[model samples]
Target chain A: MIKEFIRKRSIHVCLVCTGGCNGCDIEVAALLSQRYDLEQYGIYYHNNPRESDALLVTGTVAKQWQEKLVEFYNKVPEPKAVVAIGACALSGGIFQQESDKVGAPVSDVIPVDAEVPGCPPRPAEIAIAVLKYVPPTLASYRRKI
Target chain B: MSSVIWYLYEFARKTWIDRFLNAKTDPEIAEAPSRFRDFPEVQKDLCISCGACVFSCPSQGAIKLVRDEERENIFPVINKSSCIRCGFCVEVCPTEPKTLKTGENYLIMEEYRILPQEKVYIADEYLCIRCKKCLEACKIGAINFKDNVISIDQSKCVSCGDCINACPVKGAIKETYIINIDEQKEIINTLIKSLEGTINLEVERIRKLPDHDPDKIIKLEYPLADYLQKARNIIPNDEMIIKTVEKVTDRLKMNIITWDDEKCNQCRLCVNECPTGAIKYDEKIGKVERDPEKCLRCTICYQTCPFGVPGLYVARFLLKNNVILITLKPSQIPIRG
Candidate 1:
């Protein structure tokens, strides 16, 4: 009940970067600006995974980050949702050709609730995806509990 | 004390509030530009199944040809996941409404539109004599001879069929019809049947005659021009129809010229009259010798020979079960004495 009440008041999103061209990171960062104003909807960009309710993952998971990504996902508290941003996070993007350097998509390492597909998805699209998917995922977790 | 008062005054003014209130937000991100190329939309009916889109696509497995179970027509299907939305498929689509469209307005330009060709003219490199006659005959200069090869430019060609007419070799420059194949096959069948029917009666008459020589040659009583005219009525293009008839006649070996060595009086008349120099008197052989390889079978020697040395005969053909059976028969016209 306390978790639901906290989520109802405000949602905290943690931005995770495994490995990519950093183009999707720039677009995600755009959401913080007043133009997109992601915080207007009571969403806060928290650096800590434990405090965050949702995790927005960008870039293909490189070999080095493969183990660290699972550790990061485990750190997030229960009733947490993961949203994959950009083609790289979804399917390894153009780095798919270099199979040796980059691991498979983020979904293979951790469960993904929603996906926003584009070379570098628009900030509005990422904002919409996070808003639409995170609440339902949290609600389903509450029912399980 | 004055600096402190100035700081208080600057804080009270709040000059940054206007910029924050009028923030630039791009609410129109969903509304893409007119030329923004998204995934291609396939129009199955407009596709001619030429595979041009498939050939032109840069991304592998982005577009593939699929057969329709109900209509039995082949059309292209776009794979959304693999497609990069390059718009190459839309640009190369030859249909009017276009088989594939990316919703781009610039594709409607006159220069980008490549219409589906009804018939494409191509030169058979092996058969082409490289005489350059077609190059000269083409008014638009669509035909080119480069590096010992003759090629036709499809973009510049008007399909006027002037090059086919100017070609000395029958099959050198050919017309390949990409559309209405079944209709063309029907017309060609009718023409072949009519031609076969006309020559069938004479073949039966020769078979019934007792002690009749199969080698005997006679003139055809009826000219084939009327039957050719009937074929021309169906296919308005004279060159294509003529080429079709010529191909059929060539397969049947319509004319056979037989020369009698004894009848030649050594007058050397046929040798003088022969256009291709196929007939020549060899002093070693002590008689006139005709080279079969050089002979065009034009029947010039048959016409010029006074003593009836060279004989001309027509052949009747029956195509049964995919096999063509040819029979030689003498014509009904009286032999010149």
Candidate 2:
């Protein structure tokens, strides 16, 4: 019952930044500000992967991210969805073919469910993507109902 | 009494009406209000797969120009799985309409992934002369020949384009098709079926003739390594070899000799005895590379190997797995039946 209650009332999102300009990271921060009040949607952002239900990743996956991304992905609990935010995570953005970077993308390491593509996606777009990724079977479905 | 008026003023400021009045009516949700640059789009008609956009993009495999076999043009494929949406593909495209562009609506929101797709290398049958050298050089047993035509297993093909490099004729072997493993298997099955049909026809014709008599000398229809001297001396008039023009069809492969590297010590004696300099022993690297192009198949090196390293090989050695299906043609067989 407690597990069901936690799953329904709260969604903890863990954000990871690999290689990029961090433009998407800035937009993601705006989603939880006083004006946006992301808590109203029952989405709680956290840094710890153990407690997080959803993971949001930003930046073009560089060589270093190969090991680190998989490490963080493994830490996230079961029944979690991965979201790749911004163009870098989508297609390595401006750093796509740079030699100094690694060859793999975000999905190359872990399974990704949703992609919000933009130079830096808007807060509303990021919000919409996360909400959509939450399965209809979850307790969040009652809130929508 | 003055402090009571101040408290009433503070309560009025703290009221819900004051909070409602202070809140802004609308807020800008996005960073830029009107910027259209986001996801890059390729103009199919205007853009030539010149690799300009792929080179310009910062991501290595993100913006790829895949060759369209039908159009004979390169098509820019933006790998959405890792696209950073930096709009570099748009900036470098030289076309008038700017073959690549970024816009608010040009987003690919579908679920996507990058898989290791299998690609095949195709050899031109008309140009290939049933050479087994490519098969010998190939580290992986992905290639085989049926009746002198090359057959490839796409699943095993790593798309290394080594066959292209090994081919004597320019553009004889083409690296084509970027497809998934499932689709590649379907194409290979159909190709192998057609090749087997041609091989069976040759097999049937050879089987109809009588056995060769040991008493009578046989005039070999196909050239053998023993005929190396004849090829060098005779002014040939064959279509593949014209003496006046000196146009040579040198793609012919016959395993003239085999050497067991383990038994033989690295002696430069065999290298020195080679007439055409086909064998080269680099003392610095302690490596030996045999150039098939220069080899006349004159058994001098075979005779010089003191360690009994050389094994006499026939034309049948060219066959994959040394399976000789039909070495003796109808000419060699007497029509007793």
Highest-scoring model, DockQ: 2
Clash pairs detected, candidate 1: none
lDDT of 1 by residue, A3-115 (tens): 67678558899999889889889988888987777887678998899999889998888889999999999999987899988777876655664345676578889999998
Kindly list the per-residue Cα lDDT of model 1 for residues B1-337, writing each as its tens digit: 9999998777755666555576554657535566767678888888887667765665444566665767856678876534546677888887898888886656345332155677778899999989999989999988888999998877787788889889999789888776656656766787656655555456545434332365653333334466556766676766566555555655654555666677788888788656456788998867889997666555657756888777666676544333344566654323332
Every candidate's DockQ is 0.02, 0.20
Going through the candidates in order, the fraction of native interface contacts each one reproduces equals 0.02, 0.52
Model 1, which residues run further than 4 Å from truth?
A5-9, A98-100, A143-145, B1-30, B33-35, B49-68, B71-83, B103-337
TM match of model 1 to true structure? 0.43
Error at A35, model 2, angstroms: 4.9
Q: What is the lDDT for B182 in model 1?
A: 65
Candidate 1 chain B has its poorest 10 consecutive residues by lDDT at B203-212
Highest lDDT scorer? 1
TM-score for each predicted model, relative to the true structure = 0.43, 0.39
Worst 10 contiguous positions by lDDT, candidate 1 chain A: A91-100
CAPRI-style class, candidate 2: incorrect
